[model samples]
Target: MYKDVNNGELRKGDVGKSITVAGWVSRRRDHGNLIFIDLRDRSGLLQVVFNPKISSSAHKNAQMLRGEWVIQVSGDVVQRIKGSENPDLPTGDIELSADKLVVISRSKTPPFEVDDDLNIDDLTRLKYRFIDLRRPKMQALLKLRHDVTRTIWNYLSNQGFIQVETPILIKSTPEGARDYLVPSRLHKGQFYALPQSPQQLKQMLMVSGVERYFQIAHCFRDEDLRADRQPEHTQLDLEMSFVHQEDVVNLVEALFSTIVKEVRPTNSLSEPFIRISYDEAMERFGTDKPDVRFGLELNSITDIVSNLGINVFNKTLESGGTIRSLVLPGCGYFVRKQTDELIELAKSNGGKGLVFISIDNEINSIEKLSYENYRSPIKKLLSVEAVKSISNVTNAKPGDLIVIVADDYKVANNVLSNLRTEMGKRLKLYDTSEFSFVWVDNFPLFEWDDKESAWSAMHHVFSAPKQEDLEYLETDPGKVRAELYDLVCNGHEIGSGSIRIHDRRTQTRVFNVIGYTKKDIDERFRHLLDAFDYGAPPHGGMGLGLDRLIMILGGEDNIREVIAFPKTQAASDPLFDAPSFLGKSQIDELGILFKPTD
Candidate 1:
C-alpha cells in the first residue's frame, strides 16, 4: 500500500506527526512563494502546502505539476490558519507541510472534467468510464452497490441460504423474452442459451434437495432495450424449498426493509408493503405496476354515460366499451391549445380522443345546463343531468378538470393511465423523496398470444396456478390466477417471484395448457423433470434486479449510472468496442458459418 493514511483521515489530531501520502493532484494554486495542492484519492481530498523556505526543491517540483499527476509526498500534518480553513471538506482544518515530493506518474488532460458537477453526455462518459469512475458521485454509487450486494449475501447466509453457482450455458426454452444464443462447437446446428434468470436451475436445485440456494447471477435476454433495461443484467437469484407465496413475500419484505434501513437510512419505506391484486391495480391505477406517490386515480364513469346521448359515450358503449376519467385538481383554466394537446396525447395512447370537461363556477346543480365547460365536440350531445352525474361520480369540484376516455376497456384504461402519469409530471405532483412500494398479486396465469394463435405463460410455465383456480385451468383459462408477486416501487418493477410447481405432473399440465406438446416439453426440460422424480419439495424463488435497485437507491433515472461497465441501448460497449468480428478459424472451430449479403 502506497501510504496507508487516507486523505480524509489526516486531521488536526495528527498535526505534529510525519506521514507519507499518495494520490492524484486535484488542483494546484501558486501564490508566488507558497504553493497549495489539493490531493485526491478514493477516500477523499486533502490540501497540501509547500513553501520554498521549507524545501526549495519540493516547492519547485510542485509548481511544475498539473492536475491528475499521481505523486507521493513525505510531509508533516499541521492545522490550517484559522481564517483559511475550509469547512466543506472533512480534512479542511489540516494541511500537509511537504518536505519531499516524488512524481509517480504523469497524466494527460482528460477530454472531460472528472468533477462531480461536470455535465457530460452519456456516450462520452461511457467512452471514458475509467476516468468517469474517478469522480466522487460515481465512486459513491459503486460503493453503495457493493454494500447492497454484501448486505444481501450476509442476510441470506444468516438465513441458511447456500450460495450456489449455476451454469451460464443452458438450453433455451420457447417462452418469455427472446434468448441470447451461443453456438456449440461440438455439435453442428446446435446452440446454448445464456440463463435468463437462473429460473430453471434454481428450481432444479430445490428438487435436488438443496433446500435453499442463492446466486448473484448474470442474466441475458435479447430484447429491445429501455433506459432501465440492458441486454445483460445481474439479479440476486434465490430459491427456497417448501415455500409458498406468503413465505416468499415475507422473506423479500424482510430483506428489502433491512436493506432500505441500512443502505438508505434517509429513505422512508412502507412497512408491510401495500398489497393490491392485479385486477384492483388495473381498475384503480390502470397499470399493474402503479405508482402510489399521488392520488389522481382513475375512476369508472361507465354507468353515468351508458344512457347519456353523447355520441362518444354511446358509440363506445354500443361497441362493448367502457368510460373512465381522472380529475386533475385546479386545472380548469387550461387554454384550448393545452386541452387539444392533452386530447392528442390520449389518442396516441389508443383512445379515440379525450373529453375535457370543467366544472362551471356559476352553477352547481345537476339540472343546470350552464354549469358545464366542455372541450370535446360531443359535449352538445350530453344533457346537463348527464354532466352532473359524471362529475358527481368523479368527485369533480369547481376549477377541477376532468379528462375522460371512452373506448374499449383496455384502450380507455391505458390511454387515461398514460395521461395521468404524464399530467402528474407536468403538474409537479410526484415526490421524488417518497418511496411507495406495492405488491401486485393474483396475476393471470396465461395471456393470449395473438401472433402465435395460442395462450402463453404470463410469468412462466412453471409458476403454479392458484389453488382455488386449479379446476379452471382447462375449462376457463382466462379466469385462472397464478401464484405470482411483483415488488413495485414508484411505477417500476424492482423484483418478481412466484411459487413454482415442484410436481412433474402439474408441470406437464401447465406445459400442455400453454400448447407445448409432450415431445417439446421432454426435450427442453427433461433434466428438470428427471430431478423431480426422486422427491421434489414444493419450492419458490424471486430475483431482484441489482442494478435497478441501486438506481433507485441513488435517485437515478437510468441504471447505467449504477452499473460499472454498462452497455449502451444498442448493447454495445463503446470503451472496448466489443461484439466485433472474429477470425474465420475461430468461427469454423465453433461449427459456425457467416455469409454477407449486399
Candidate 2:
C-alpha cells in the first residue's frame, strides 16, 4: 500500500508510531542541514522533516523535491517542540520524521499556484482546472456539494421517493431555453436533445404510478450564461403525484431547513420562510426575488408628483409612466459628483433619469422645509405643497436622501431595485451570514410576447392555471394566474415549481394560449399528452439548482465556485475547448453540412 495513514490523520497521540504517508509537496524549505516540507492530500496538510542524522539517503532525496511533487514517505511521527507547533493547522502538533522517500510523480511549474487566496483570472484557472481544484477552498466546495447531494438523497428516500434514472437524451421540446442537440450518426437527419430538466419524464412517472420520484439530474441548455448559469448544470429534480402547490413547498422547505441545520450550523436561517405574492413583492421591493433583510422598500410617488411641472415627471405621467422613490436614511449630504454617479447608474438600468432630494438638516415638519433645507436638481420646480406631499407619502425625514425615477412602470421598478441592492451593500444593511428565504408566488400564467406578437407562458406551458381564473384562458389570457412559485434566497431565485396540468384538456388550453397550433402541439408534446390519458395523477415538483444552492451555502458569489468544471460565461469550455468546429469525417458520418462563413 502506498499509504497507511493520510497526511492530516497524524497527531500528538500518534507520536513514536511508524507509518507511510503519500501526498504532494505543498511547501518546501531548506534550513542549512535539516529540510522541511508541507505535504498536502485530500484530508489536509502535514509537515514532514528530513534530517541527515536520521537517514542520509532520505535527506538527500528530499533536497530535490519542489512544489507539487507527489511522493510517499515512510516516517515516524514525533511531537513538535513547545511553541514551535502551528496553531492554524489541525495536524500541526506532530511532525513526520522521514526514514525513506520515494518520488511517485513530478510536476512542472503550474500556471497559477494552488493557493486559495491567490488572484487568478477565470480563463487561466479553468484552462488548468486540475491544478485549480487542488486548492483547499475548491476541495472543500467539492466536498460540500457531495454532502448536499447525499443529504438530498437520504431525505427524499426516507420520504418514500423512488430514485429514478431518467434518460439523458430526450425528444426536443420547447422548455424555455434552447436545446443542446446531438446528431444521430446511425439515423440521418435525426438528432437527440439533452434533457433540460427531466420535466416531462418525471411527470410520466406519475402516470406509471411511481407516486413520488426523484433524481440528481444532469441538465443541458444552449442559453446565454452568467455568474449563476452554465451550458450544463445539475438539479435536484423531484415530482410527487397527488399533490398541490402547498405540498411541494412544504416538503422542499423542510428538506432545505434540515440540510442547513446539519451542514451549515453556523449560518442562521429563518423558519417558515416568508411568503409574498409576485405583485406585492414587486410593489414593495421592485423585484420578485427580494433580499428581505434590508428595508429599502420602493414607494411610488406617482400621484403625489403629478402636475409638479418637473418636465421628466410630467411627461412620464402623461405617457402612463410611474414615479418611484427609494429613501436612503442619512445620505442627505451627497455632493454633486456622488449624485451624478447615481444618475448614471439609473440610466444604465434603463431609466430616463434620477432625481435626488436631500434634507440637509433636522426639521420639525415637511411644511417647514424650504430651499435652504433641500438639495435637488428640480427643487425650484416643486411647490412646497407638492414637496410636502411627496415627503409624507415616502416617509422621508431629515438627513434622508429620496431618490426618484420617472419612467415606465417596469423600468422604474427595475432601476430602483438595482439601486436598492447596491446601496444595501454599501450600507451593510444586513448580516451576510444570514439566509433569508422567501416564496414568491402568484405569477401570471402567460405574458404578452410583443416581439413575437403572441402570448407566451410565463413559467412554462405545463403549469396549471388557478381554477378560478381558468375561465379567462380564452377570453383574457393575461388575467389568468398560475400555481407558480419561486424559492428565493439572498436575492436569487434558487428554485422554481408549480402545480402541473395533468390532463390533456387543460394542457391543450395552455398550449393554445402560447400560440401553439394543433400540429405544433402534436409534433412537440404528443408523448406527454398521450400519457395523460392513462390515469395520470395530479403532480407538481421543483428542479432546485444544486449549483446555486451550494454557492449560497458556501458563501460564494459565483456558481462556478461550487461546480467542478463549469463553462465560461460565454458558454465555452476552456479546459476541453468545446463548441469547436467538427471534423469533416465525423460530420460526414452524421450526414451534416456546414455553410461557409466569412
Candidate 3:
C-alpha cells in the first residue's frame, strides 16, 4: 500500500508524528517560500504544506503539482491556524507539514473540475466517470450507498435471512419489460436472458426450503430509460417461505426503517409506515405511490363540473370521462403568463388544457370570503353555483388557485398528478427533513393492453390473486385484485412484490387470464411449475431498487449520481463506448444477420 495514513485520518492527537499519505492533488497554491496542496483520497481531503527550508526538492515538487495529480507525501500532522481553519471539513483543525513528496502518477488538465456541487454537463461527467468519482461529493454518495447496503445486510442477517446468490443468465420470461438476451456461442441459436429481478429464482429458493433468502441482485431490462431507470440495475431481493403478505411487508418496513435511522442520521423516518389500498392512494394523491409529506391531495370535482353546463365539461361527462382538480394555497396572485405556462404543461401531458381559477380576494371578491367570486379565463362559462360547488369540493380558499382538468379518467389523473408534483416543488412544499414511507396495497391483477388486444399483468403473472377475488378471475379479470404491495417514499416507488401463485392449477389460471395459452405457459414457465410438483411453500417477497433508494437517501435527482459507472439517459456508456458493433465472424457464430429497411 502506498498510503500509511488516509488524508482524513489525521487528527490533533497525531500531531508531530510523521505519516505517509497517498492521493490526488485536488488543488495547489504557491506562496513563494511555502506551498499548500489539497490532497484527496476516497476517504476525504487534507491540506499539505511544503516549506523550502524543510525540503527544497519536496517544495519544488509541490510547486509542480496541479489539479488531480496523483502523489504521495510523508509529513507531520500539525494544527492549522485558527483563523485559516475550514469549518466545513472534519479535519479542518489539522494540516500536514510535508518533508518528502513523490509523484506517483501525474494527470493532464481534466475535462471538468473534481469538487462538490459542480454543474458540469452530464455527458462530460459520464465520459470521464473515473475523474468524476474522484469528486468529494461523488465519493460521499457512493460511501452512503455502501453504508446503507451494509446496514441492510447486517439487519437481515441478524434476522436469520440467509444471503444467497442467484444466476446472472436466466431463461427469457414475459415480465412486462423487454429482455436483454445473451446469445450462446456453443448452443447455436439459443440465448439466455439476464435476470430482471430474481423474481422466480428467489421463489425457487423458498420451495427448496431456504426459509429466508436475500441477495443484492442485478436486474436487466431492455427498455426505455428515464431519470430513475436504467437498462441494467440492482435490487435487494428477499424471499421467505410460509410467509403471508403482512409478514413480508412488516419485515421490509422494519428493515428499511432501521437502515434509514442508522445509515442516515441527518434525516428522520416516520415510525410505523402508513398503509393504504392502491385505489385509495390514487384517489387521494393521483398516484399509487403517494408522498404524504405534504398535502396537495387530488379532489374529484367532476360531479360539480358536469352540472356547470360548460361544453368541455359536459362533453367529457357525456363521453363517460371525469373531472379532477387540486388547490394551491396563496397562488391566486399568479400572473397570466404563469397560468398559461401551467395550461401548456397540462396540454403536453395529454389533457385538452388546464383550467386555473384564481380566487384572488384582493382583486375579485364580493363578500371577501369563501367562494365569494373568482377571476379566471373561463369564469364566463361557470355559474356562481357551479363555481361554489367546485370550490367546496376542492376545499379552495380565498387566496388559493384551483387547477382543474376535464378529460378521460386516466388522462385527468395523469395531468393533475404531474401538476401536483410541479406545484409542490414551486411552493417548496416537500419536507425533506424526513423520509415518509408508505405501503400501497392490492393493485389490480391485470390491465388492458390495447395494442396486444389482451389483458396483461399489472405487477407480474407470478403474483397470486386475492383469495376472495379468485372467483372473479375469468369473468371480471379487470376487477380482480392481486395480493400485491408497493413500498413508496417521497413519491418514489422503492419496492414492490406479491404473494406468488404456488400451485400449478392457480398459476395456469393466472396465465390463462393474461391471455397466455397452455403452450405459452408450458414453454416459458414449465421449469417453475415442475418445481411446484414436489412441494412449494406459501412464499412471497419484495425487491427494492437499491440504486433508487440510495439516490433518494443521497438527496440526488438522478440515480447515476450515486452510481459510480452509470449510463447516460440514452442508455449508452460514454466512458466505455459500449454497444459497439460485433465482428462478422462473431455474429455468424450466433447465426444472426442485420438487414436495412428501404
Candidate 4:
C-alpha cells in the first residue's frame, strides 16, 4: 500500500500522525544534515523533510533523490518551522517528516523542467508530451477540461438531450477544408474521409425524430494550421428538433454561463452573452470576433472623409469603398519607422496603404515642418471638417494615433482588424483577468470566391438562409444572410452553428448557389436529401470547439497547450511518431501510392 492520504491533503492539524504518500520528487534541497523534498502529485506540491534522527535509512535514501525521481515515503505530518512557509501553496503550512522511503521508479533527467512556467520550446514539449502532461499546469488544464465536459453532459442530459455516437468513417462532402481520406483495402479506389463535423449526421438525427442530441464529436480537416487550429479536433456537437435561432442561443447562453461560473470563477461572464449582427460587428470592431475588453474600436470615417482631395481617399470613395480608422490611445509619438511598420502590416493584409495621424505636437522630422505641420502630410491637405470629424468620431485626443485605411469594405476590414488585434497586444490594452463573451449572428449566406468566380457557403451550405433574405438567394447570393451564430471571446472565434436547411428545395438551392453540379449534388447528398423526404423537423444547433474554448478558459494563447496529445502544427504527432510510413505490403494492399510531379 503506497498511499493512505495524498501529499497535499495534510495540514497543521494532521501533525504527529503517520501516513504514506507517493509521487515524483518535484524538487530536492540538501542541507548536509537535513534534506527537504517537494513531492508532487496531481493534487499539488507537498513539502517532505528527511531527518537522520527520525530514520537514518530514509535520510540516506532521500540524499540520493534528485528532480523528478519517482518514490514513495511514509512520514509524520508536522507544522512547518515559523517564517519558512510558502503562502502560495495549499500545503505550505505543514511539512512531512519521512520515517521510511521507497524508490518506486527511476527516471532520466528530463530535457526541461516540468514544474515551471510554460517557457519550453513547442516541438520539445510535443515530443515529450508524457513528461509535459505531468506538470501541475497541464494536469490542472486537463482536469478543467474534464470538469467542463462532465458539466455539459450532466446539464444537457437534464435538459433532455440524448447522448449519441456518430460514425467516424463517412463519405466526404468536404465542408470548409480538404478531407482527410482513409484508403480502404476492400474497395481499392474508394476512400473513407474522416467526419469534418457531425453536421449532416446530426441533422439526420433530427430527421429521425431524435428530439435533442449531443456528442463530443471528433472532427478532422486537412488545412493550414493556426494558434487555435489542429488537423483533428473535438467539438460539442448538439442539435435540437424544432427550435428557432433564439432557442439555440438561449440554450448555449445558459450552458456556458453555468459552466463559466462553476469552472472559471475568476472570469465575470455576462448573464445573457452580448449578441451582435455580423455586419454590425465588422463595422464596429473591424472583425466578427471582437475583443471587447478594451476601447480601441474601428470607427467609420467614410462620410467624414469622402470629400478629402487625397487621391487614395477620393478614388476609394468614388469606387464605392469605405474608409475606417482605429484610435491607439497615447501612441501619438510614433516615429517614421513605426508608421512605416504599421503601413507595411496594412499592405501585407491586402490593403492599398495606411494613413497615420499623430494627434500630438510631435513634428515630422523628415518633413521638418513647424508644430503646425498638421497631424500628417495627408491631413495637412484635407478640409478642417474632415480632420475634426475624424477626431470627434473616433474620440482621438492629443497624444493619440489615428490609423486610417481606405479600400473596399472587405479589404479595409481585414487590414484594420489585424492592426486592431496587434495594437491591443502591443499596447497591453486588454485586461488579462477579464473574459468578454459575445454572440455574433446573422452571417452572410455566401462569400465570393474570386479564383473560382463563384459564391460558396460562408458558414456551411447546410445553414438555412434568413427568411427575409431568401428572396436574394437566387437573384443575389451575396446579399443573402444566414441564420448562423458564432461564440467569440478575446478576438478568437470559439465555435459556430446555425439553423440548418431541412427541406430539399432549400438545400438544393444552396447547392446550386455554391455551383455544385446536379450530378455531384445527387452523388454526395442523396442520403441526406432522402432523409429530408422522410419528414425532417425544423432543427437548429451549435458545435463549440472544445479545445479552443478550453484554451480561452484556461488563459492559454494556443490550443495545443490544452490538448493532451496534439500534433505539431504541421499535423505530425511527435510523441507516437504518427503520420509515419506503412509497410510496403500493407500500403500495396490499400492501393496507396506516393508520387510527386509538377
- Best candidate per TM-score, number? 2
lDDT of 3 at 63: 80
Which residue runs does candidate 2 get wrong by more than 4 Å? 362-368
Model 1 misplaced stretches (Cα beyond 4 Å): 360-369, 372-376
Range of the 10 consecutive residues with the lowest summed lDDT in candidate 2: 360-369
- The residue pairs that clash in candidate 4, if any, are none
Q: Could you give candidate 4's per-residue lDDT for residues 1-598 as a string of tens digits?
A: 6788887777778988888999999999999879999999877889999999999999999889988888999988888889999998889999999999999998899998877586888889989999999988899999999999999999999999999999999997755789999888899989999999989899999999998999999999999898889999999999999999999999988898888888989777655678899999998888889888787889888878876667888888889998899988888889899999999999999998898887664532322333453468586676555566677889877677889998999899999999989999999987886778899998998999999899989888899999999989899999999989999977888879999999999999999999899998899999999999989999999999999889988999889989999988789998999988789999899888889766
Query: Mind sharing the TM-score for model 4?
Result: 0.95
Question: Could you tell me the lDDT of residue 160 within candidate 2?
Answer: 98
Show model 4 residue runs off by greater than 4 Å.
82-84, 361-373, 596-598
Q: Show the lowest summed lDDT stretch of 10 residues, model 4.
A: 364-373
Query: All models: lDDT?
Result: 0.87, 0.91, 0.87, 0.88
Clashes in model 2: which pairs? none
Greater TM-score among 1 and 4 belongs to 1
The alpha-carbon RMSD values of the candidates against the true structure, listed in the order shown, are 1.9, 1.5, 2.0, 3.0
Model 3, residue 137: C-alpha shift (Å): 0.6
Pairs with backbone N, CA or C atoms under 3 Å apart (clashes), candidate 1? none
**RMSD in angstroms, candidate 2?**
1.5
Query: Which is better, 1 or 4, measured by lDDT?
Result: 4
